[model samples]
Target: MTDSGEKESAESMLAEIEKKITDAFEIFDHEANKTVDVREIGTIVRSLGCCPSEGELHDMLAEIEEEEPTGYIRFEKFLPMMTHVLMERRYKPSPEDQLLRAFEVLDQDKKGCLSQEEITKYMTEEGEPFTQEEMDEFLSAAVDPDRGVVLYKDYVSLMAIEET
Candidate 1:
């Protein structure tokens, strides 16, 4: 494509992205105040199909606010932050981080480990529940035989090893 064509394509892509962000803002700005609070920000990020860790979400919010006082983020300000997150998602993928976050969600008690019962509950609630055999296999691979729990570190290491 020519330089002009490339520039036009870039502009079009940006416009489309902006439109999607605007639509999301409208959907999540529940109060119709044209702004989203910190809690709503998490919902918005998840609504976009991104599962950022709690720390990541906090960091993102901090980066968005800078030194400003805690308050709602106007759509105008949120747009750039959302764009940056999307860029980071594209350039620096972190499946490990996502997995850890998922584990954390399952480890509801903040126990640093998931017991067989916990895994079963989560998988069952996830809508195509795991079969008994699949559940047993997953538990065997993920859980520590001695502790009978899937520690966070073990889970992360196992997932990383599998990736390679």
Candidate 2:
């Protein structure tokens, strides 16, 4: 693409991202404050399919606050964070790293493996709750029956196989 063409594409992408951020803030800003709170930030990030660690979330909120020091995130502060996340997602980690990160989010107890109950609860909590059949199928495919838990390695391997 020519320089002008590239610039236009970049502008178009930015505009689309801005629209999406606006729509997301509207839905997740529970207090109608026109700013996104910390809790809302977590929900928004998860809804976007990224599982950031607690520390990472805190850092993101802090980074946003550095400019304005508001407890909540206005669009100007929110845009850069959203852009960073979008870039990270576009250049995703390896499948193993992705699975490990996901497992860390799901393993609420830090047990290094996910219990069936934990998986079910986490999946259900996401806006579109998983059905019993879907959960069962996932367990059958991802869980280790002997251990009765979903190990990170096993889950990663299962996903790798599925992609083939």
Candidate 3:
């Protein structure tokens, strides 16, 4: 494609993405007043599959002040906040439920933990098996060596803390 053609393509794609973000925002703007309750902002963003960390959400919220005493975010503020997030490819963490469900599948015994051997087998034999070094790095933080197991729920919580 020509340079001009590629530029147009990029512009159109951005326009389409903005349109979708507007549509999602409108879902919460039930009154059609171009604003939505401040509290619903996080839910709306998450519903659109954006996984912004809590700090990022706070920053976004800080950028937009509510116009009324009741607290709301005007669509004008929401659009660009969401646009930058999407365009920059930010906020891609998997939801907690997803992480838990994946661990649940591997914890066949439903004991809320996985043995070291089980973790090693899955991490080494499963999809995109980790290299010995990678596995070592992963396990160093993911396991409780004294207990010889990983309480996945605790580990996931720990990861969530560190991720932000």
Against the true structure, what is each candidate's TM-score? 0.54, 0.53, 0.57
The lowest-lDDT stretch of 10 consecutive residues in candidate 2 is 155-164
Error of 3 at 88 (Å): 0.3
Task: Write candidate 1's Cα lDDT for 44-136 as tens digits.
Answer: 876555656656777878877636666787887789878767655532334677778888877778989987877888876776666686688
lDDT of 3 by residue, 1-164 (tens): 56998999989989987998898888889899999998888888876667666577888898876644468888997888788887876776666777888999999989999988899999899876667976887788898878979989988864542232
Q: Tell me the lDDT of candidate 2.
A: 0.71
Question: Residue 113 error for model 2, in Å?
Answer: 10
On lDDT, the stronger of 1 and 3 is 3
Best-to-worst ranking by lDDT: 3, 1, 2
As a whole number from 0 to 100, the lDDT of residue 156 in candidate 3 is: 80
Better of 2 and 3 by TM-score: 3
| Residue pairs that clash (backbone atoms under 3 angstroms), model 3 | none
lDDT assessment of candidate 3: 0.82
RMSD of each: 11.0, 9.1, 12.8
Tens-place lDDT per residue, model 2, 16-120, is 766776777789777776777656786676555455665667777787764656567776777778777865563222466676787797777788888887888
- Candidates' C-alpha lDDT: 0.73, 0.71, 0.82
Alpha-carbon runs more than 4 Å astray in model 3:
67-70, 95-164
